[model samples]
Target: MNRKVIITCALTGAGDTTGRSEHVPVTPQQIAESGIAAAKAGATVVHVHVRDPETGQGSRETAFYVEAVDRIRESGVDVIINTTAGMGGDLYLDPHDPTTFVEGTDLVSGVERLKHVEKVMPDICTLDCGSLNFGEGSLVYVSTPDMLREGAKRIQDLGVRCEMEIFDTGHLWFANTLVEEGLIDAPPLYQLCMDIPYGAPADSSLLASMVAQLPEGAHWASFALGRMQFPWVAQSVLLGGHVRVGLEDNLYLSKGVKATNAQLADRAKTIVEAMGSSVATPDEAREMLNLRPRS
Candidate 1:
């Protein structure tokens, strides 16, 4: 087992989880504070996503990202900032009229999606490898090959690390193809996203299989949503992969109890130490992931 594992804390995701958990940060200040807290709690990286402060709804605003990143930077937190470039791909098709797009659909081009990342130049940004049936009904997370190539190239050009997000086995194959095409840089970074509906389930067998499929010399982390968050932390380390934990993926520390991002990071750190693995610091994580420092 790899003793030096990096922990990434997903501070606030652009999901419908505000009302469900009060600890989910909504404003830029709150998000920055949560990120700093996670870093202090042993997370080497902070994966961030902004929301509409007033409504607590997910947004794709550059101003929100700028504010959040500024706050985190000003706070002098020694953690790698990993922004979300996975937005602007939601496609909710109409059930009755399949040809027509639904109201909540926010389909955007690849260039539009990377605007924030380009402007802020965060140390790392997410690039979802492939599309999948996001949830029940006609909802789908659309990430086409052309779009993926465009996003990957842009992130590479900006000199920011792209954290390839894989939700299923097919996604892993597609990511490997990117490496073959030279779109993804050497020593690729991957996040094995599990437990999402219609994606790879959060099971030890499945996690092991996914880990085995990763390209040689690739740095990777694995996380599960909701209740599986803590368990998957140990499971990932056991499988020779890193770990991620936060309110973005899971809201509860236990049954019917909500957890903040700092709490989640602390819990994951506890598990990693218990397994005889030491947590990687931000500088070590930057070197391992091949991320450039912000200017």
Candidate 2:
């Protein structure tokens, strides 16, 4: 097993998790502070997703991203910033009237989604590789091949590292296609998202099968939602992959035990060290991932 593993803390996801866990940061200040705390707790990178301050719902507002990034940079933390460019692809179609889009639908062109990333130029940006059945009943996250190609092109043009997010096995095929098409840069990075409904399940066999499909020389990490979050850290490390943990993916230290982002990072760090593996610092991670050094 690789002893030096990079840990990424997904501070807050674009989900309705704030109501469930009081520790999930909602505002720009809270999100930025949580990022800093995670960095100090041994997270080399922070995966960010902004939410509406009032409703606590996920949003793709440029102002929110600007404020969050500014606060994190100003805090003097040494964590690599990775913003979500996977929003604006949610397709909530009406069940009866498929032709009519739902109220929550935030469908936009792939290029539009990268607007914030173009402006902020974070160390890394995520590109969700494919569409999948989100939860149940007609709800789907649409990421067509054309859209993925377009997004990958824009991300590459910005000179930012793209963290390809694979939700299923087919998504990995699409990511490999992007690499073949030269849309993604060399030494690709991937995030194996597991245990989301209708996607790849969080299990050893499935994780191993997914890991085995990774392209050669690719840097990757894996995370599972809810209870599987911490356990996957050890599983990923054992499979020669990196680990990601935070309140976004999970908010509990145990059954009914609430946890903050920093606390989660600390717990993951302890597990990594106990497994005879060390956490990679921000600078070291940058080097390994070939990311542009943080200014």
**What would the per-residue lDDT of candidate 1 be over residues 1-295, giving only the tens digit for each residue?**
8799999999989889998988999999999999999999999999999999889988999999999999998998788899999899999988898899988899998778999998888988999999999979998999999999998998888888889999999999999999989998878999999989999998899888888888899999999988889999999999898999998899998998888888899999999999999999988887787777556
lDDT of each: 0.91, 0.91
CA-only RMSD, every prediction: 0.9, 0.9
Which residue pairs in candidate 2 have backbone atoms (N, alpha carbon, C) closer than 3 angstroms, thus clashing? none
